[model samples]
Target: MNPLDPAGIFISFEGGDGVGKSTQSRLLGEWLREVTGRVVVWTREPGGTDLGRVLRQEVLHGDDMDPRTEALLYAADRAHHVATVVRPALERGDVVITDRYLDSSVAYQAGGRSLAADEVERLSLWAVEDLLPHLTILLDLDPTVGAARLTDAPDRLERAGDEFHLRTRQAFLDRSAQDPARWLVLDASGTQEDIHDAIRAAVVTRLGDALGVADGASLGEREVG
Candidate 1:
């Protein structure tokens, strides 16, 4: 793929359970297409491709698996996702937006499960091979609030409880704080319109040139220094 196109930005949406990631991702994807006229490919982690979706079901629904084993499953799904979906889309100069990525694993499994963060990061680096998203938007919300939005009984991970979600939330915050330039925290408590507005603003401010024209200032050209 040529490196000159400015349409190769990958933006990821992240947060704890029921933090409105799905809703915001849809809204943002639609808005980007309407405003920027760039083809947008939207997908979710652990389930972007066929193999990834199967692995996602295993990891999310199957019986108890060790943290390391579960983490490996997630990494596998991510690898396939990046290879089949994300990489191809970006090579075609499409804006690929994913619902979650390595950060979710680091927060949920490593941070919440008490596994080593360094280990998770190391494994993720191997899985993604340095294809980090140009921007990660983390929707910050209270664990209780986010969990309550789920109508059905909790899944294995969701049943991990409020404390687990709290830890995951903190993990996300810590990561965003650590990498201020790459991550943006949007409050997920208010109206959907408000949340969408904030997200749009962040995208425009962070990826101004990439939104419309093909300039060197686009995300494809500028590496996160």
Candidate 2:
């Protein structure tokens, strides 16, 4: 457990838009709750809390802002989320699975917006007090292919040009490569069930007896909060 959050397991799913991160994150959260019987907090950045919803709307749907303004807005949402929702859940020893985390800011602001990567990362670390996820799943897929999967009206990021998304995809790959032990990179082109199975296997291996899964001992009932 890190100093900011003394307990609980933190997991995150990340990828380019339409890589099925939401589907996979929810599936893994449900499976974790079913097998481990622990509280699973399924959430996402820029929309995790009430305040986050406002920020999300502004960042994605409202008027366009400069890159710095965009980065700061994301950081603001993240800081509040960690302080209110995430840190409290961790302190209660619940499992927290997020759809995206600091990595998204880095990918979007730094990679897509061409801002300084270090600056972007440092801003996020400061916001969350360096509370990195225990595990981060990067669903790797071609940006074009992933974009093809989106059905809703494209948001600001989704509407970003091809080159922007290509850079964002590369940024995610680079981050995963830098931390292979903490990251599970999988081919997102596969079926959702296949991705879930792979995530479960890795999680089982990573969590083990620490989470009482070494012998299938149920932890508690699943609670999504």
Candidate 3:
């Protein structure tokens, strides 16, 4: 897959809610900034930009809509996000790690909501002008287990029935299997630090040459420049 930026990395975290995408995104952002000496932008789909925030609230907490409508709304959010937030940051040679991206839309809208999978994917690609993450980390976990971890009121996707979530989970796995090079699948059942370690190791490989490009040298005990 062609990277969005050769020097500026793009990464996305995906999983069912409470699978630790937020926690791990935070960790990865901090690590990339500290280790690679690059400005790391931590953002999320359907909520990364100001417009996305409104779309996110309406999609997740507002009234229900048909699958196609839902899918289009997410695509609109992503289009604006990539145009305003993600692309600009990457153009500046920054590492952009998003909590969720196109995959969530495909999985939830297509798999969970029973729309055509390829159509859902196509819609998103069209929205973002085919911007794909350089690397996407999928925190694999049982949907029920992930649900149990959530303490607050569930959102629209989380409130979706178990069968819907199961289908969504399978969609994520299927997508990851189809593109192993673009994805790193880790069991989310592990401890947070353990999962983070695995994610960091995978990212380090991609950043093998990027470290030199971003920092002018390999990372060392030296302070981040």
lDDT pick, better of 1 and 3: 3
lDDT per prediction?
0.85, 0.88, 0.87
The parts of candidate 2 lying over 4 Å away from their true place are 1-6, 215-225
Q: Which stretches of candidate 1 lie over 4 Å from their true place?
A: 1-6, 213-225
Per-model root-mean-square deviation over C-alphas: 5.2, 3.5, 2.8
A best-first ranking of the candidates according to their lDDT comes to 2, 3, 1
| Angstrom error at residue 107, model 1 | 0.6
Question: Which scores greater on TM-score, model 1 or model 2?
Answer: 2
Greater lDDT among 1 and 2 belongs to 2
| TM-score between model 2 and native | 0.93
Regions more than 4 Å wrong, model 3: 1-3, 213-225
CA lDDT of 198 in candidate 3? Answer: 82
Instruction: Give model 1's TM-score versus the native structure.
Output: 0.91
Model 3 weakest lDDT span, ten residues long: 215-224
